[model samples]
Target: MQDDLGFDRLLDDDGFVARLLGRTRSGRQRKPLYGPDLPVVFLVGGPGMGKGRLLGCVRHDFGRFVPTAHLDCGAPAVTERVAQRPELRSEVTEALREMALQFGKWQGTGGALPAPRLYAGLLAVATSDRRSSTESLVSEVREQDGLLPPGTFWRGVLSRAVRGYLAALGGLVATPAAVPIISAVLDELLARMSREGTAALKRCYGEYPGAGGSPELGLHTLAAHFQQGGQGRENAEKFLFRALREDIEAAHTSVTGRMTRVGRPALLLDRADNTLGRRLTRAVLEDRERGHHDRLVVLATARREDGGRFLHPPGHADEGRAATWQPADGGLPTWSRSPVGDPGLASPGRGALLVRMPLLTRDQQEREIARTQGSVGTGAGGQGLPVGPGFPGSGPSRLRVETGIRRLSGGRPLFVSRLAEATAAFRMPEEGSDWDLLDAPAGTRDEQEEHAVADVLLDDLVVRQLPEELPPEQREHWLDLLSHLSVAHDADCAQALMRERQAEREERLSAYRIAELLRDCGWPHCPRHFIGDLGLRHLLARRLYGTRAGGAAWREDHTFLRDRLAGEEEGAPDALFGTAAAHRMHHHLAADGAGNGHGAPGAEAVTNYLARTFYTRETRDWCGELLAIADVPLLGGPDDRRARALGAGGTRGGAFHRRVDKLLHVVWLCEDRARTVDDAVTSTLRLLLERLSDESEHGAEVLTRVAGEWSERAGNKQALLPCACTGHIR
Candidate 1:
């Protein structure tokens, strides 16, 4: 069942997949290639945003074309390989060894990237003690030799190393055969390098306060210190990483003849922000800093945009920035690079390219929906027509269903795919609209055919990604906590919500902690917003509002926020025109507005707030505030509840009510811009301009300008697509 939810299982998007691989639609490689050419490319996105899925696609689609090996940094298989040793550095070595094995097994254009130097260094660390036998060391080296592609490079380097070690020993070893093969090889290489060549390794360990100045002892110290972490541990890790890259360079040179027709070997690191992964990435950056170049491209997945700060320094300008996959002339997604400086270098700036994992554009999503519907066919005794609104394959019905999906998914592939699958299996009545299907009763006798898709989506997108360290009960508590906090606008508001729930005790659930968890799980980080992704936030918010306490939890939560803000406003009266005021009115309307023929909440207060702030803030700023407050996703959709309540002019019959209503009507129109542009909405917009004109005639031109700005900012009418996923890269 879980395998069926695979992104490629339901959609045929090979063109997009090829684009991700830096290939043309016809699967030809792009020159000046960004995918395999770049030393590091980060695929950044939130959980269920398809970062892992993209990696899967790369392996499945392009494995034969490129010499690719994938290692999940978070997978226990990697760390478990060296459980007896139990060191992060050892885990990194194991990871590299696994990659080397994979590269050797591939029958592709790029041959194996043999890491003899790395293997020798690790072997030395394993057998540096006098009690260890030469036979064990020989066996270890021979074992690694078998995994590498057939080459004389290891034997030649090891033979030279053995000769050097014997000469240095000078009868200290009574028997020549007693000397360890790998340790001798590593020692010889360290000595063979020029002073400048070895200086970087020495400097890395120089900061470490540990003893052992010799190269063999240094290797031992580095691997040992990996357990006792600090600057010393990091330096040790970097030293080993540098050795790995050096080996890779030599290996690349050796394999150059075979790799002419292929791109560089790819190391796909999934969940690269994990402990072992971070070390590998940081080492690559440091290697690049020292002007070390290798034909090894690292394609890593990062939960954060700055590659979890390993790719770039803190306070980086492009932090949390995301862009659409705008394919260049080469037919690959255009990427942005931020140069990260290494302080160790005199001229220190090696950049990492950040490539956001692409979300499906609305057109692609609609196509996928249509495709799934066609494949699933009509249920029970119906013809093989697509199942949806109007007549089975009617345009209006398709459009309506697509619009609902856009609202629910915001173009997230997982959400869209699951929803499409569910829609295909369920047969709706001729009179029922897409909304009925989406907001169908969870436990009705007739609709008893389970909402399996929604459940799976919720689990995969939210619950399943939570930390496994959490007790089963605590996981539920945390989910509920996140659901309630999803309504929070920023860190402060989220922290406030946490405090109100008194949930900061056992789990230490705070804004920063939650942010960290969200990031680790591959969710976007909107510093200004909690649960950054809109679709995700809405999903959790839906759970909060619809499921718990029979819908009372929604009002109760909003009312708590309203009362909390009201208290804050009492102490700081001046904050009424600030963020606090906008948030307060947001909670006010969400909590009090029934939208069931009842009057809007605090209509007079809302009117006063808008009237006072309209002139002070810029037109765009005012509209932004209005949208922030008005764009609440109520159970009945954005329109029926919040929009209708705000648009309704209650008994405050005067210029104030009319003026506020006109402005709010503009907000609703923009929020629902994807829907059919009806005459009533258009007429309401014109009424706003006229009302603004009346104000301007009285020498108050601000309102008229504000209305125009709002309309223009909503985007031109004809260009407005069904939802926010309008940026299609075709």
Candidate 2:
């Protein structure tokens, strides 16, 4: 499907294996040692950061020479084991039965299947049986082979079947009984399989002999064996270690094929800090130390705190110069200085290199868009037909694609690729087309383009990272936070809002726990508060604000803005003030033009109110002084009655004076705004005073002067201001 997205190809081009192997090109084949002594290398990043893709590439490229295995550490088998308790027994029994059947089937098939295919079939059979018991099914398989005495063969069949069942269960549950039983059986079975099966299993687990098993496989050997396969316990472990040793030997071996005893494998662990628990980190370190191949090299990826935890000698490292291996000398590498850093550490070696993935330049993005669209059009046309009309033709200068890449991707490659895919699918028209640009007609080509891009991205790119099947309370929390953050334009403000939401969620969680405890003790539980993460809160908020069903009710019921206002003292003032001002501006603009007769006074009043309510005394005074000096057009022409009603009596003079007094007070209160405020306030006040100077003068000198001043202030000296005082203003 779509050439399997070519992930492997991308990784190959990116030199992932070469980097991992710690090799550089100086016209010599130099490979780093990889053995029991070396630390394990972990590639970590967010989902779709190409960790899995790089692993795939490594396997594909070195499957023959190095014997690589790739397994998803985050697989459900490892993560969901604790939740599968009730079904554990049944699951184990079913697994054994299926594996017995598979053994029989393999025998019947002459045992000639490819290792990968055989293992795949076996795994599939075991997984299927876990859903439904395969006792009868195994019998059927035997019967098909013309094997008689179902009773006589059933015992061994059942035992083998049980072993298989334990193997399946072992992957999911690390248990005393299951691990030993499954491990023993697997050891026997693996001894019987061809070399290919062994190799395949090795690749599947990413374990080599001297290299040891993945720490994700856990502490126990039996447990690891069962996790790997049901019938290959000892051999699996041996194969894993052997593969590691072989790879290390290969790396250190001279071109003449002689082994050179060098330092241990240079382990490059990336983002090891993200492991869910300390147990995992400990297990990985223990596994490496236990092997003791020679000259161990352990490289781990982690944030500073996480790395610090491991820098201390592991609890299990009791033997051989433990005192010498101090925390500081634990062979930690720092890569913070380099752009890409060493995926292995925070810093780089002298010959070490970093290749930070760069954001696509505007020109690069445009070219890519054009190339993608042109290719798609050409593919659709068949043969040598010209590509779509959107593709630029020969000209003095090539057309520039004006779409904002930063707006679309935030400089993330995954986001960029996703947006590019969406844009390509919709075939968005080239910029500056004759069609209306700002607002596209509903269901038109442009609308389809927008929808297509948003839909694909939201579904394929954004939604995958979310927790599985969010609960109602969690959903609500997510939505509320997202709504608040979405309105923030400043990056700092957005990040702060997110952090605040996270803190609030933690408090809510604590309250939820207290309520739950109360409920258990026959006390009334509060329904208002619950616990969850910020992501959950954001998700719920998004649904509430954007959806039709519960969205309206939720918005109306929740007083999030009021709550935020109450906590304004704890918030960043700049952000809070800006948000409050914007909200007020929006409300004023939306008020049906009914307030203060002419609406202008109402709008101006709202601005003044924001300056008073949200801003500090200094900011408020400065803003007030500026507004007071700003000119107010005189009542005239068709709207004269409305304007006159608004400016009734000494109300206009009072409003102007009151505003000026407020500005003066602000200037007096804040030393920072005093001198500047006078200049700003005086200019505006002078313009308004000029407007009401005289009738004849107002028509010519007053209006003309104001127009010239307004244009100059607006940085558009030739542009006319739309004056409500004019007859044609309405």
Candidate 3:
């Protein structure tokens, strides 16, 4: 977070807090900030809108007030571990372990340890065998009431807790009136520790509490009494749990009061929804129901979608106050609150205020653009802005560059930041100075020109952000992975795609590094399955995939990704068809429409593909894109005028007849099934009809027959007007 990567941060702590806890959300009334609510706030934003950066800003500002416990909860391995094992110890305990250790190591001996590395894996001090030891402690703590303070680095906690409890309970346990037995046991154990050593004392703890010689032995013997199936084990366990919890809480409170003189301490959850969702939910509920976190302000960050659980725990309903997670009191509380939910969508869940981030304003845009310009060409695998003293250094040139970036980035801070970074990265794929790419205005710029710039930016950022710096030969595989991501449709499939190629790498691209690439490329947020920014994927698709030669190679690549996904889906074809239906349809048409080699077989494939799309419910979602690309003979678009020229230049023959037949089948499908025909589709159909109807007697005859069949099968759902095929065929 304290990196010297050069870009200036946009969100300021004080101002961001004002905006975050702002009075109005998109201009609607929200619940007023209240004392009863846990200081848990969800800072919500979409991809590249500075959500990640917002977390960084909070750490800078809020860490002083709240001795921050920072965890990059979305690290791929961390997320995987939770999804697999999901024990509370693994999620929150281990995280607290990391923070305590990170801060502890930072506070080592003399000076504070260096700020914890950003996006570093979750474990901090707990490494190698420590991982196993911590996990075991977590399980033991969960099942048994542990009085062992989780604070391993904080010296004297166990000593102090044991001593205090023994002081209160020693006489009672001595004659043992009502002495806090657990504390007395810890004291006895601590006393033995000066002579016997910690390991031997701890070993003595597992022995019989009734066989107590020392307080540690007394506590453990008591524990063993309950554990060995006696009556008061539950009460004993609960007391010990409370003791442990209080000790941990006191340790945290001790640190908190000393951290800052600010109003209250805050907890900054940096995208822990996927990993710590269940734990945070419980913590907040405990704080709410039991008034545990009343003194702390817990500010958690997450993608807008995950604000639901952050706002309220699961099984919670009836305002944000009630827990269906327990039992619904039916109909609900009049004092119910709608704290958490998508404010923009007005879907309130638990009663937490939602502050959804808006796109950058003009002033903010200019500030970012200026920052971009300064950072560029720093020789940092970055794209430097413009240098021309004539055009861009002046008024109109600056305006054009600002306008192009704004147009490309849509004022989303992340996109703009990366665009600046890419510009500074120094390798311009296009021929012009950065001027044309950055200068083109919204309407004045060529679509193709804007597209090329986006692809270059995507490539630049992907490479620059990639872990383990890819070499040239493996770069192709890396590019292929990027391409595959554009079409993978979701995070799991994308990960699987990476795993598929992970085995291919021996020298580099290990399995963990491949997964870590997700966070490296600014995907620390949830909903990772879908590309955080769709425009990035679209640009990658259009650039890496081309329309030359029917875009056959492009379709081949799409099909290649699709086939691999399908194979992975194995018996669950629905897994491929249901989730990524749009992607599959796009690829299927692209590949099936590669009607070059097979004559009748190709024609049948096209017909079958069209028929299924016409009848299926899933096809409705992507029919618009299908029609847009399917107009040409292959998956190529209207921009491929050269292909149009070649197709129209032909003399009609039997082979040509089949080609025309394949092309006309789309029109026939359109006539029978399309609810609407776009001007582009109609125009392309007209040109095809006009050309083929006059080609030769046989070509005309074949065209007439297909047109007749389509006209006969035409239904009410057909476009308001028939394709020109009807008029030309006769």
- Report the Cα lDDT for residue 224, model 3: 44
Model 2 C-alpha RMSD to native? 15.8
Report every candidate's CA lDDT. Answer: 0.56, 0.32, 0.40
Model 2 CA lDDT for position 537: 25
What tens-digit string does per-residue lDDT give for candidate 3 at 76-136?
A: 5555544654422244444444544444332211212221110011111111122233334
Lowest-sum lDDT 10-residue window in model 1:
721-730
- Ranked candidates, highest lDDT first: 1, 3, 2
lDDT (C-alpha) at residue 67 in model 1: 64
Better of 2 and 3 by lDDT: 3
**What's the CA RMSD for each of the models?**
8.3, 15.8, 14.9
Model 2 misplaced stretches (Cα beyond 4 Å)? 1-16, 22-30, 33-44, 47-50, 56-65, 75-282, 289-367, 375-402, 425-452, 467-545, 549-606, 610-616, 619-730
For model 1, name the residue pairs that clash: 46-522, 46-523, 47-522
Write the residue-wise lDDT of candidate 2 on 320-409 in tens digits.
111111111223232211132222332112111122223344434444444554543212223334546555442211221123222334
